[model samples]
Target: MNAFDSVVVEVADIEAAACFYSAVLGSDSPHVCLRASQDPTSGFRGFALSLVVSQPGNADAVIDAAVDAGGRVVKSASKSLWGYGGVVQAPDGTVVKVATSAKKDTVPVSRDVGELVLLLGVEDVKASKEFYAGRGLSVGKSYGSKYVEFAADPGHIKLALYKRRALAKDVGVSEEGTGSHRLVLSGAAGPFRDPDGFVWEASASAPLTATA
Candidate 1:
């Protein structure tokens, strides 16, 4: 099945952005990275996604495809100050960074890969629905009375427009500092921020176990 992959963040520069991410997550530089080429006529091509570590057994091939697709290299593959290592950029504007351990093993750490589904606050639910529908994303069944799920990918969702206050209460968190909390869900999980700035995540994984 077509699964949800990584979330794409449009940045002005791949190297600078990678540095910021490494600092924020306290991880090493991205092992696999890509930079977009300067070609307006290149049609649907610009920027790159870098992976700090290799992915499964498809590292070399994936890097080649990214370069062939018009992505430029910002930083060649190298080790970082941290023990783990990564590549900088490819062609498209997306920057990807993975951990060194995963790269050496050439296996994905998570069983399921996921994407970040942004829940934008809209003035009207019906109006928002129509806007996304026009973009070719299918709206799916509603979850209870508050949420209306919209198909993001083939089997995943992007936006779950709902009443702002109600969603905040459901998630058991205040809208303040919503973005600060990193909610890691199971594979292919969709996490979103509500209209009122409330954050919520949906996953099909088992509950978290308490640590001593």
Candidate 2:
């Protein structure tokens, strides 16, 4: 299915970012990698990483841990028609979200993240979707030219695409950006850059989990 095995985030401060992500992501990770870079990126950067939890309480706990670890809350945790969730921006300007479809707590609050989703905000959702589909990703969900999600492999990071402006609004950031995305995906189908400039490396080049 060409499922993603991990993600690499380029951060300006290696030592600090290592510690911050460790605290926020906890032990059960969706295989996030950190690389040191000082890429000249600004504004939204066209992507957001999401931590999907089991319940609202877990969402809150994740959000709180992120805040305690030097992240700024872009959207406060709250209930919405869809459920409860919030957005936070790490010190290095990486946008992350903690969310859940369950409105009520199923278990006691803990830092248990059920799934991790990498959302790419592209200029054309349909084109991006087709581009990925051609490379072997099976579409799991879709909303015309607005959004599309690919089926996930067991215990692997999920992938999705959203329109650039809509994604920025959802993540509470500006859509305008230039320079590198400062992000990379590791999967079996890659060693290529997507239509919107997202870089992907072969999974053989990345370990299941790493920092710096």
Stretches of candidate 1 off by over 4 Å are 1-112, 143-145, 154-157, 170-173, 176-212
lDDT of each: 0.36, 0.86
Q: Per-residue alpha-carbon lDDT of model 2 for 131-161, expressed as tens digits? A: 9999999999999999999999887888999
| Candidate 2 segments exceeding 4 Å error | 27-30, 205-212
Q: Indicate the worst ten consecutive residues by lDDT in candidate 1.
A: 41-50
In model 2, how large is the Cα lDDT of residue 189? 80
The lDDT of model 1 is 0.36
Q: What is the alpha-carbon lDDT for the whole of candidate 2?
A: 0.86
lDDT of 1 by residue, 68-141 (tens): 44444443444345434323232323333322333344454421223324333334566656654554446775
Residue-pair clashes per prediction, in order, are 33, 0
